[model samples]
Target: MSALKLAIVGGASTYTPELIDGFARLRDTLPIGELVLIDPAADRLELIAALARRIFARQGHHATVTTTTDTTTGVHDADAVLLQLRVGGQAARDKDETWPLECGCVGQETTGAGGLAKALRTVPVVLDIAERVRAANPHAWIVDFTNPVGIVTRALQSAGHKAVGLCNVAIGFQRKFATHLGVDPELVRLDHVGLNHLTWERGVTLLDTPDATTGTEVLPRLLTEHGQAIAADLHLPLPVIQRLGVVPSYYLRYFYQHDQVVKELQDKGSRAAEVAAIEKQLLELYADPALDTKPELLGQRGGAFYSEAAVQLIASLLGTDHRTTVQVVNTRNDGILPFLPDDAVIEVPATVDATGVRPLPQRPLEPLYAGLIASVTAYEHLALDAALHGGRDRVFDALLAHPLIGQIDLADHLTDRLLAHNRHHLNWA
Candidate 1:
């Protein structure tokens, strides 16, 4: 087999180095050569190229590195492409979270106004990259690692690209739940279903065990007892356990918002101001001319986070010896659950390889939980249609279909307000 060529977009999201580190860490286990890095910004690309070369040189491995501002040049002949491009990254995320708070609406990372903002900015860019991949390397598998992942991934898929969105939050919550219950996350079976940032934990238990207690199970008891409070104490943006109960937190903004908590923040000052301050600090660090002098500050910092786990999962599927401990993956439903949609994005255990992803089968959600999941899938499909066709009515129907949005006569109100407020920003307009 030839050495796999990996292409990474958005070379400056701070995720670049970690992914390089992930591939490099597995160099002894799996052969990866010729990393191609692409971004429109030259300075960031230079920094990333320098860092990657230094790391490769240290291991006495000769890795061909390609840096380009052009997508076609970078992605052509690649085996896999990881899309990490952010329309604006943290600066935009803060705006998304702060804008709704300013309007007395629930500002969030993945729902309502903030999500709408991100979708508008993200759709065009993601599609552009997807199209380039199609034109350049028709066989490459594209893994999208962007926020509002359900929306973006759906867009790429509907546009007829082989793509799946990736988020580490689910894996994080699963491990925490396992720790709380004194069980291995791998052994626990999860009947999880929902939209990207908003999913429900319809059911959970040991994968193979003699029938025992129900609510008396350790996982459920732990969640019911200290889940919400722990989330609060941690200041976690999403209430993983509280919103989905036994399910992993799929960006909780879709189901619940602690209005009081947000109100308190507003009462004190502006959340956007806080974001600006953080941005200033990051920008200063990024702009410092002396960063090259400090070895520690030259590349991605902090030990391995879950984002790298996605790559390891892919390596496992490819039959590499570099297997990961745990991974959260999206795979097609092949009757594992009779109730859930066959094409719905599922959170399940998977093994990956050059052949493709293989998801383990699990039980179905309860009827009521399945219905909730259906509603979210409906929104995902419709929103994807709207993004692809530029149809206002489809977008309207998606808002109408959402349980929370539909309950509040949100279709007309949200559509009109967004049409008027974001006419200039929206790609559809």
Candidate 2:
């Protein structure tokens, strides 16, 4: 069998080592022959190249290492491409975070108005990369790790490429809950279904175990029977969990911001400081040697949280495993939300094997939640149309779908901003 060739794009310095180690561990099953590293930053790419080479050398893996600032060269002939690109870094992220907050809207980088802004900035880049990937290696599977994943994945799918957006938040919560419950992660199966950055842990099950029970049945019992002691026993950071609270998988803070999560996002909260420090360090890491050595974490429990969901997809494609877990993947909506634009990009349960990914049909979301996702999907469509069609009306449509911007002012605001900020890119007739 020919060796698998993997391409890593963007923040290659931070994400490459973990992927190198991930593939290294899979040598027995899926041996890699090449690691193609792509990043616009030459120095960061060089350091990553050195680390990958050293790691492979130490592990005695003969994975050939290649580095490039050029996308075409790096992605050419690749079997699987893992992309983690960010447009403008923290400064851009800060804008995404602060701008919406200023608008009295939910200040999130991955959803709503902020997400629309990010999609506007990032969709063009993603499409260009997808085009290159298609031209270079039409057979390659693009595993996108970019934010606004739902929107980006939709764009790639629209452009007609095999692609899936990957995120770690849901998986991290599953692992954390499993650990607290003293269950093996692989044994503790969960049903995490929703869009990117917003998900609910629908259920958790112990697969094929003799004493298996439904999460709904088991969880309430666990919480009632042993809430306080369980918190003490597990030493969990979520003290609220000691009081029978079910932690919704992603953006727990936003949902509980008025209560339990208020502290987590506050200045005194560990999470807020953690995010701040990491952002600061990332800004200076390129110039300073000290931050380069600082470990990079992709999930809640450090590197473990960022395990390649792509590997599961690859394994499924090869049919090497009987079962695998993946989160936030999109497929045809066969009823997860009956009214939410049946074609909307929804995160949900997927079963994969040699045949392909089969998104499990799920119960329809309640009217309110379904409507929220529908509204967001509307903006998603308009954003893509604006990017591909480059019309002023499409930009207005994108803003119109947003709840924060009413139809009355949508065109005016979009026009003023489009003229002022996106003048060169906007198409006016």
Candidate 3:
């Protein structure tokens, strides 16, 4: 097979090296001839590109790494363009993680009022980039890794762009389950269902092999054996997982234990602040000519196993792997979740291949999970609307619809604070 060309739109991100590491290590899965790192931050872009090239060289991979600030130029003729954007960067995220505390809500980048703020700031920019990618290479697939992925991906697909959203949550669970089962990670398949971030692993199947179609259901055994360990990892009690007979995404804590989480968030510095500090250290490390490998500190920067998830998704989408694989992705519901509208973007296990992603059929969800999923799905629709056509009223409506901020008074306060904190990023604010 001829080598493919790939692009990373937010290549200046500290996350770039993790991706580079994946491309270098998984060269057989997805061969690339050229990689264009596109970002407006020229200085950081060059630093990341230089490190990326060194990483490729260290791994004996011959891919040429390039950098550009122009989206069209960077994405030209690309087979796949990965979006890892942060519209207003960490400074905006710091506010997203803080201001919502005033309303006694969980302040997070990908949920609640803070997530709505991020969507409003991010959707327009991503749409513009997607248009440029479409203009340059209409056949190229857009793999979105941006946060509040459900909404952003909905925007991309609603605009009729060929796009899918990828997240590490499912893959992270797979790895953990694999370790517990003492099997290879590839042998573990999760019945991961629900919207992005708001998902639960209803089942864990131990496949006969990496490519096997049949497997033994091991969720009951997993809960019986590693329940405490798993619960500790999620920071939720074992009873919660046992009571539901499923492991909820760690993000669910923002909803399940909203008040407690708010107090914890209020008492601590924002995750954005912590990541900003890590990025600083990472950049310093990247600047080292001798540093060809991703530093240890990068592990703590989050998005664990993202590179593997991304490479697998891109490889499958481009047909480079030539094998049908089931991976959890955010794509159009299209009736996968009977409770959601067909157009709503959902994060669930799906079969990915060159033809595109088709969400796997799922068993019915009980009202406990279904109710929240329906509520958040509604908020996501309104959030996309507010992102597409910016206005204070639309923003308030989205916040009001969010399960975490359903109260009128809290939504009002959050709406004003969100607008105030993000006015510079929102054109119509």
Candidate 4:
């Protein structure tokens, strides 16, 4: 097989170097002949591309790195396209993290009312980009890393694009569990299930080997021995995990502790502000000619372990290693969960290889978790509807359906605020 040509749609992002480092370190897994960074921000794009070249050189990898503002040119003949673009950038994210708090909702980028705003702004743009990728290379896979992943990915698949959504949550948990178990990270497999941000670790298994298909279930042991540490990592009470017999995603804090999270968010500055400051520092660091590795500061910038996750998924999708691996990915449900529609995009452990992703069979979901998953799944359907077709009522209905803002009056207030802040991006508004 020939070397792969991969394109990153939002390659100018501060997160690019992390990916560059992964590609450099994992060269044997996913060999690339060329990497095209596509972004409208020309200045940042150049800075990131220069650093990417330096990182590759430092690792003695010879893949050519290129930058372009033209989407069609960048993605032309690519084997896979990765979407990481933020629609309105940090300023819009700041709004997404703050405005919802005014109405007593948890202010977050990928949950509740604010998530709906992001979905409204992002879905249309991603679809347009997917079209370009499809036109350029009909067989190229589209890997979505955008916010509100569940809704955005659903839209892509619903439109019949070869798309799959990915998140760092599962990998992050796997790494943490490996540290606790004193085992190789690759040997740990999680029974990770649910929607994008909303997911749980139903079982933690230690594979006999890295590529083994069966493993010993160790979730009960982990909970018994290191439950407190795990709970601390999630910032949830240890009793909660013990009671449910599953570990919830940290994002579930927004739902499990709604009022308290709202209060905390109200008291603190937006995460976007912190990221903006970090980006400024990272850009300055990137400007240094002597720097050849991703800075320590970038780790604090978030998206931890994103590069590894992207590399593994891309390699598996391209069949570079010719091994079918079960990874937690966001893909079509197809009866993985009896409760959701087949078209609904779900985050669960799935078999991934060159052919495509297929959701693996899962143990039945308990009502406690299933109810919230079903509720959010319905909200996601509505969110996609509002994103595809634009209207105030559509936005209102999506927000209303969200478990975080089911109250009519609260949805009313959030709808007006959302449209007000996003009118510039929303053509219909």
Candidate 5:
């Protein structure tokens, strides 16, 4: 077998150490022969590279680690490229996460108006990098570890690039469920469905495990056994879980209790500001020269289990693993959920192997869930149009279509603010 060459775009992120730790620890899963860290931020890259080398050395791994500013050069011979880039950096994120609160909407990186702004700024940049990667190495699989994953992954697939989107949300749930059930995580399978960030864990099945005494429909047992704990994790009332018989991803709180979330966001301030401070401290620690391993503070920066999720995805996709694995990923719906359009991207359990990602069959959702999915899918359609084509009207239309920004007046407010805050990114605007 050929040695695995992995190139990480945006390798300068403070989160890079988390991934590096995984690479060193899970060397058996992915024998990375040559690892390339690609970034334009030269100073950040320097600090990250030094730390990556130290981590590898400490772990006694011999992966040839390298760094570069040129995307084409860094990805030339790589078999897989992971994208975790932010187009305008945290300054843009701070703007995205704060401006929506001005309209009394929940400000977040991957939902509603802020997410639309991020998509408009990010999709184009990601596509450009994918094109460059294709030019250099046609066979390289692009794994997107970026936010607004559903939209970005759809754009890549629609353009015919070989890419899949990764998020740790599903894996985090799996681990939590496994811990609660006292079983190995691999034994637990999630009937995870919906569009990226907007998803629910409707079913939990344990595969031929001795501890799976409750059988495939263990969702109710989970609710009955740990409803309060699960509800607490999602910041939802226990009755909601008992009523719905489904565990909503934490992102659902924005839709389920929009007003509450908006008020909470207003009071707590922007998550971006918190993460910016964390990143600053992390960079200081990275430059410490004495420090090597990933620090605890990195967990507070979000994206828990990100490296494990990415590694499993890459290992499964590259044919390194013998067994086909079911992992949650963002890919085209293709009727996976009957209610959504074929082109709309959704996050769901997918079977991975050398062939490609195939979303497993999803049970029909209740009208309540299906209606929301349909409405959001429509908004995503408009969102992608605006992200790709660019215009004020398109932006307004997308926001107007969103459930969270349904009012025309609010949509208009957000559109102007989005265009104003992101004019440098949206050239046509």
Candidate 6:
């Protein structure tokens, strides 16, 4: 087989080295001859490229590390393209996180009115990049790890691009649960279902285990044996998990307790600021040529297990992995959830391969979960529309449809704040 090439669209990000390390660690799974880091910021790209090279060298791999500011040049002839671009950067994210607080809403990058703002700014930019990737290498797979993943992935697919959205949330949980079960993560198969960032692990089956048989449901054991720990992870009370008999994704806190989250955000300040500080520190660390491994501080920056997830998905997509892999990805519903529209992008466990992704059949979801999924699907529809066509009414409708901002007054306030913070990015604004 010929050596493969991969491109990272937002290669200047400090997070790029973590991915580079993954490529080195999982070298057998996804071999590469050249790795291109594409970014507009030449300064950060230079630093990131140096660190990426050092990481591969430390691992004794010869993947060529290259940097480019031109999208077409960077992605040309690549086998896979990874999109992690942050349109308008952290300065913009600061506004997205702070303005929503004034409206008494959780200022978030991917879950509320703030998320809507990010979608508006991000979708068009990402679509253009996808187009460039398509032109450069039509066969190249687009792996998106961008924020507002469902919206971004849906946009790429809607434009007839070959794309799959990857997130670390499900894998992070899989690893966490595996540690609790005293088993390897590969043996854990999570019944992870829902839209990106919004999901639940209803059933966990151990594929290979002595204490339990394959396909055995162990959600109860996870909750009962490690209820407090699980609850702490999601920030939900033990009583909630006990009553539901399932583990909700951490993002659920924003929906299950919207007002409380708003109060907390108001007091705690924005997460972006904290991440900004962390990124600053990481970049400084990345500049140190001696530092070849991913720092422990990267854990605090979130996206745990991102490298592993990306490697697994890319390996499956490239047909290099021999066995069929079941994993969570953000892709079209196609009846995966009977309640959602067929075109709505959903994050659920699917059979991944070079041919394409096929969502597994799931048992009917309880109304408690199904109802919100439906409502959120509706909100996502409006959110995409709002992102594709910039208008105050479209923004208003999306916010109103969101369960977190259903009230007319709140939606109105949120729409204004979103547009105001993101006007420069929105062409129609």
Where model 6 places Cα greater than 4 Å from the true spot, the runs are 209-213
lDDT of 3 by residue, 307-402 (tens): 999999999999999999999999999998887899999999899999999999999998999999999999999999999998889998999999
Shift of residue 28 alpha carbon in model 1, Å: 3.3
TM-score of each: 0.77, 0.79, 0.99, 0.99, 0.97, 0.98
After superposition, the stretches of candidate 2 with alpha carbons farther than 4 Å from their true spots are 11-13, 209-217, 222-247, 252-304, 318-328, 334-336, 391-393, 404-429
Q: List model 5 lDDT by residue over 248-353, tens digit each.
A: 9999999999999999989898888999999999999999888879989999988888888888899989988755878899988898887788988999988888
Model 2 Cα shift for residue 229 (angstroms): 12
**After aligning candidate 4 to the native by TM-score, how far in Å is the CA of 262 from where it should be?**
0.8
| Tens digits of lDDT, candidate 1, 1-429 | 557788889875454656666566667555677889999888778776776766666666677877999998999988778887767666666666665565455666566655665776778888989899999888888887776787787677667787766766565555666666677665554555555665555555664442222222355665676666546634554355555455435345335455664676467654445655644444455454444322444232322344455566555544554443334565554565566566656555554555666665555565655676677777766666666666567667766775556734556666665565456657567
* Clashing residue pairs for model 6: none
| Candidate 2: residue 225 lDDT (0-100) | 64
**For every model in order, what is the number of clashing pairs?**
6, 0, 0, 0, 0, 0
Better of 1 and 6 by lDDT: 6
Which stretches of model 1 miss by more than 4 angstroms? 55-62, 88-91, 174-193, 200-250, 261-280, 283-304, 317-326, 333-340, 407-413, 420-422, 425-427
Candidate 2 lDDT score at position 263: 34
TM-score of 3: 0.99
lDDT of each: 0.63, 0.63, 0.94, 0.94, 0.90, 0.90
Candidate 4, residues 231-291, lDDT tens digits: the string is: 9989899998899989999999999999988888889879999999999999999999999
lDDT of 6 by residue, 1-429 (tens): 567899999999878877988899999998889999999999999999998888899999998999999999999999999999999998888888889889788889998888988899899999999999899889999999999999999999989999999999999999999999998888898899888988999899987542233567899988889999999878898998899998999999998888898899898988889999999999989888799888989888888889999999998998877657788999989887888888899999898888888888889999998999899889888998988887899999999999888999999988877877787788999
Clashing pairs in 3: none
Q: Could you tell me how far off, in angstroms, the CA of residue 19 lies in candidate 1 after the best superposition?
A: 2.3
